[model samples]
Target: MSDFVLTTPVVLTIFNRAHLAKRVFEEIRRAKPTKLYVIADGPRPNHPYDKERCLAARAVVEAVDWDCQVFKNYSDDNLGCGRRTASGLDWVFSMEEQAIIFDDDCLPHQTLFRFYQEMLDRYRGDDRIVSISGNNYRFSGQRLHYSYHFSRFPHLWGWATWRDVWQRYYDFKINLWPEIRDNNWLTDIFGLVQAEAGPSSEVFKTICRDEDIRYWSRKFNIIHKEMWNTWDYQFFFMCFLQNGLAVLPNVNLVSNIGFGDEATHTCSVTELANVPTEPMTFPVLHPPFMIADAFADAYMQLIFNRSC
Candidate 1:
């Protein structure tokens, strides 16, 4: 890890959680990336306490002592989850060609910086690989010999992506979902999984079925209607739309500590809350080919079916 240098910019999205932001900032400070982009949503007018808390959270990033150019994108109005995240990334890519992203609650192992830097470099020109995620759901006991595997699901607890991928695929308003939905275009992406096989083996069929498809279809319709204050679903929709895969580490690299009353979305303690992180073994053993592990993807689908 000594040879690792995080030339890629780092994007940290924060809200009214000074304590959590401070903790995440410690790691960012440790990584000492050359460029740091901090995105903050303004305090909600209804929550009288939000102003002080939001300012405190924004203050933590000011402790940057290292040689770094810190960029701040602070909003005066409350944009909620969807608009804030989408617009933040938009501001980031507008300047950077690529960036490693973090929500203040998603703490990362030190190795994550190295992992993202390398993955982003390796797949920089590859359009089929949309994004790289730091989270490993750990749904199954099986382990892979490589450092990471391809996944259709890009978990955003901690993640990275190229500017081109985001600008081309993601839509904050989800304006195209209706067109895709009306034409039943989503089936073209996962249709093979519903068949006897897809990507590699029959397990894909076992894991992704009509029920799973319907679950996602329902999700698309819901997010398309803006039922939830989220931006990730639309990102995943773009991944499927372009037949792209995300690179997910073999082990969990991020632990979400942002659960409890202060959290907007993750307000309750769940299995995903504060999961442990393990450092990725460096000089990553790349899979001989780029293919989603069907068995693993199957388990991932099952977990979504159960959890969502």
Candidate 2:
């Protein structure tokens, strides 16, 4: 473990992957945060092996021998990804004002904790900046004078946020979907033509129609159907709706290791899987002006379109 200790609280969400959970937990152990919150979902009733896997995963959290105040929000029943994660986050913000959140598959570099702590302190009162993300998927040579850039994409592989932002804007229900769609909120945020031509437009159309394509007969499988029912899209919707920006590190800090048969959503290996992490330099360079990088956003939209 390094001499550096994280002052910010960390919230980790884990399911039934013991090996991946242990790898991520080791990073958390290195940070040695003062407070740790573990949110876990119970095993699926249909899968016999899920129970044992879930137990093993939880044991990793219990094995933390560091001096920390650990909190748990393990569910007795499988609440699905949507309900379980949303409720777990609700519980987290209820107790803490702000926290750095992690999924079991998201392995962070040592500097990630320091970067989050500094960024959180720097933008604590800035409502415009709602989140700080550790993963930077853009591999382009686009260099910024700052250690981070403002983006519309709030990548949640590993991130940090304040309770005020979560409570005020993050809606699990997508309650504002109708109003947002009818009033052309997407167009307003990403330009009228871009919104109409992008993948987000398809998602907006789906949400507005409440069309359950589960039985649409054209879907490749049940996984494709379940993919639409995700909270990440809802969080992105919230960020767009609130005109909120997410700060992404200049260097990639987190690697995703959850793509396989056992994975819930990310079942296919992509270019983003297991990306090498690099340490971020201190005294973070700050952009002179607060504005989203259009080129980066366009590249991200391209990635989203391809992924869908």
Candidate 3:
């Protein structure tokens, strides 16, 4: 589709990875989004080389050659991932109603821009749908009748969302996590029975599902407690709170390529790192009904439980 033009706004969040940021920015350049917003975190004072690396990463956006309006929200002092991204996005949605988001590490396929644009238009007023995800964590394919399926989880590597979802659901402070955890509300939210973890095969399956609940429960505690800090958990908090669904494509559209010493969470190689993305063919088929694929979500839960 040579005539295809991207009109949606795009947001890029970058820290100190110049190389990875450049890779992501190049694809955005190709997509030629009409409006581009960049959010950059300042360098850590403790890290000796953070300033230079951060500056280099910020400069990558200066190479934008297309005719696009670019807005920048740069921090002079480090706000860390959680604060920087939350504050950055607050600035982004203030200017536009909806936009696709990317981290420095998330390399997007050309088709992702079109896919997200269509989803934004089709589901503009659908309050049940909170985000549009470009990630399919399963390396092995999950058979589906449509081009995409609804997901209970929010994958932030490369995703899109509207101002309503962002303003209403996203809790950077994770204020409600404690009440959910204390009252054991996740089971109700997930529609899962309160099955205890056991070893039997049928029970083992239930246990795995419970592990998914526990995995997020523990994560929320950590994020709220400041034991670990990042942006995704807070996004997920509102999704879980509202039982919101993210539209996940059948084919992977974004690849995480920043796995190295300089990386934060992706410090070591894992199956998720450098996941190869393939083009999603045209005339995307939307699912006839709006329902989360339980089989796919369960399978993903089993995979995610391995880390927990």
Q: State every prediction's TM-score relative to the real structure.
A: 0.91, 0.87, 0.92
Question: Which predicted model would earn the best TM-score?
Answer: 3
- Candidate 3 lDDT, 94-138, residue by residue in tens: 889999999999999999999999999999989889999998866
Clashing pairs for predicted structure model 2, backbone only = none
RMSD from true fold, candidate 1: 4.3
**How high is the lDDT of residue 303 in model 2?**
62
**When superposed on Cα atoms, how far off is each prediction in RMSD?**
4.3, 6.6, 4.3
Error of 1 at 225 (Å): 2.0
- For model 2 the TM-score comes to 0.87
Better of 2 and 3 by lDDT: 3
lDDT of 2 by residue, 244-264 (tens): 899999899999988888888
Q: What lDDT does each candidate get?
A: 0.87, 0.81, 0.87
Off by over 4 Å in 2: 1-3, 192-229
Model 3 residue 264 distance off true place after TM-score fit, in angstroms: 1.5
